[model samples]
Target: MRGKHAPRSTRWPIIILVIIAVILAPIIYGASSRNRTTKNQTTVSKKTSHSSISSSSSVKSSSTSSLSQSSSSSDVKLKSAWNTTKNKQLSAFMSQWQTEMNQTYSGTYDGQKPDYYGISFPTALENGRLSGHIKFDNQNTTVEWSPNANSSAKNQVLAVAVGQTSSNGYNRILYLFIAQEKQPKVYVSQTTNGEDLYFTETQNTALKDGFSQIYNSN
Candidate 1:
């Protein structure tokens, strides 16, 4: 009878210990799993923030690059305009003048033929106007004169002759560079004292007024 009671009491204590161990093991495991989940959420949020910052920086960089390219293109256009009117056009004009003067005055004026020795580069003026000087010498006499080329809406080329002398300041000659409205008919006006030489339909009064404007502007 004693042996049986002792065995039953020992069995009761062992069963109680097993039941407590089962409950405590689940509690500890649940707490550890919750901590791991919280840690993973924090790490994911940091990575997302970093990615957003990097994307925003790339957009700003692209904007800056575009602005730089636009500014460079604008500068190139300005330089092209500055270099368009070169010495070649001036040389051509001098050759034309030489041919015209040779035909008009015949052999020579004051022992030497009319010639253009030098020219000033055409410069941009106000309101789409261009001005330059053409220099020529005849019989040891040097003549410096300026040409004003005005461009208009109808693709018109109006050139004014401004004459200057050491004795006097400036003289207005009745010469022009005119083109037809839709044709490429460039001409230097002929001087007839009282007659309109080039562009037969134009009047002397209008020619004089136009020359005056160019002369005064120079």
Candidate 2:
């Protein structure tokens, strides 16, 4: 009887352990489910952060590319209008002036080379025509010319020959123009010490008219 009763007593401990496990099973499962949910949420948050960064970077890159393209287009337009070639009349005039300047300034002046002259097409002018302000010395009048209309004169070919000289800290700029027409005429304006020293043949009606045709026509 004692042996049978002792076996029954050992079975009580095993039964108690089974009951405790049954009670704790749901708690363990709930904890595991919460851990899985937290892991999923963390993964989603990381992906969202990466996506936002990528989108921002894409926008910045697009903006930079647009600005670069705009700048390149502007440069192309400027280069297209910058004229470097001279017409027949302009070529002859440039040659004559170059010869004269070289003869007058045979050596260097003020530590710089003399007879530095060339043709320059101002980009600021419409049709890239050569135009500037001319203020004569000791005079209150300032002469200026610029094209304003897109007429036949806009299509007219014009050229400017520029001659530069400097002496004793004083600089001179010589601008010459020869209208390309049936009767080509010459116009000259010279600047020294922030003032025009002289202008040649500017009052001639025929020459003025010829120049205006090209100068006023944008």
Q: TM-scores of all models?
A: 0.43, 0.39
Query: What does candidate 2's lDDT look like per residue over 113-178, in tens digits?
Result: 223132223332233223343323343332222211112232222443344454443354444343
Which residue pairs come into collision in candidate 1?
none
The ten-residue window of minimal lDDT in model 2 covers 103-112
lDDT of 1 by residue, 1-218 (tens): 45645644478888899999998999999999999999999999999999999999999999999999999997764343212242234334434553554322211111222221122112221222222221111111111111212233232333323222222422222233333332222233223222112223234453334333322231
Candidate 2 off by > 4 Å: 1-11, 85-218
Question: Which candidate leads the pack in lDDT?
Answer: 2
Looking at candidate 2, what is the lDDT of residue 13?
Answer: 88
